[model samples]
Target: MADIKHFDPDAALETTLRLFWRQGPEATGIQDVVSATGLSRSSLYATFGGKHDLYLAALQRYVEQRSEPTFQRLAEDERGLLAIADFFSELVTARCTGPFARWGCMVANAHAATQNLTAQNADTQVRAILDRHHQQLCQALTQALTTARSLGQLAPGTTPRSTAEVLALLAYGINLRSRNGADAHALNQTMQTALNALTPSRR
Candidate 1:
């Protein structure tokens, strides 16, 4: 017979995700996971394998639970440029305020951390997650920009794909800057400036 499990793996993974999101994988240890999840080392290992594996799982959860839904909304919203503006507004609000403030985005944090690692030292799985995330973000932004272009909301020369790439980088910058104590007001101003530049002049 298979061994019976005594704890909720989903709950434990959610708890572990928050721990990793707050302190990041480098600062967090297996002991930290054990402590945060209230699980023994053996149980954690039995369920999640090891530290690297657990971090990957947590990162995947973040992408699925936190990032994807937001992206989906942006891609589907018919308001186009307004939807994108709301997206950035909410992003700045979430990043600069609330319980998770200063944590930045888990994926953005991973990107920064992974950049410091040598190619041989970097985990391919993590790199894949980051790449997928970038693609999803760009795709969503592209969809929104295409909508904006159809509605004559974009600046005359703006191309959806190129502008989506620029906006994706801007989003990453907001995430990183917010982690370093950039305030909501400042971030909002930055976001507005970027959006304004993409808007057609009304004259």
Candidate 2:
């Protein structure tokens, strides 16, 4: 009988998520996963099914484990707009200074690059996933903006829903720019530009 090994699904999935984040779906191979998780081919197959399934698993893990904190910081924490601003500021700081700055965000990279499938089925699935993530971020931003409005931090007459959409787009843009090797100063300037739009003009 073959030796059955113990595995922690969450930890294994976390490793897989990091691998996929560092390298996109197409670029990551079974051997890479095996190496990262110390799982043999048979174990991986028996446990996770296949590469795509594993990719989906890793994505779910990423959404739950990684995205929740950011969502909380941006949405649940109530410094109104300041929390969002500081989040972006920290993003800028990290991108400019973090050791693995070049890796960028896996979720954003996947959405940006996954739309090129030639087959109809492949195209549909990939596009659906991308759209879903985009809407999720949009909703998160909407919540933050709504909270800011409730707290009177927003400039007068600013609509929470509309501003949220714009801010979500700004956040996406900043992530993309960082992936493109934009520096801290550049990101700071972008943040400033975005904030300026939200700031109320005095009479």
**Top-TM-score structure, candidate number:** 1
> What lDDT does the true structure give each of the candidates?
0.93, 0.75
Instruction: Write candidate 2's Cα lDDT for 85-114 as tens digits.
Output: 887787767555676576666667777766
TM-score of each: 0.96, 0.85
Instruction: Estimate the lDDT of model 2.
Output: 0.75
- Compose the digit string of candidate 1's lDDT tens values, residues 3-99: 8899999999999999989998888989999988889999999999988889889999999999999999999999999999999999998998889
Residue range with the least summed lDDT across 10 consecutive positions in model 2: 115-124
Give residue 147's lDDT in candidate 1 (0 to 100): 99
What lDDT does model 1 reach? Answer: 0.93
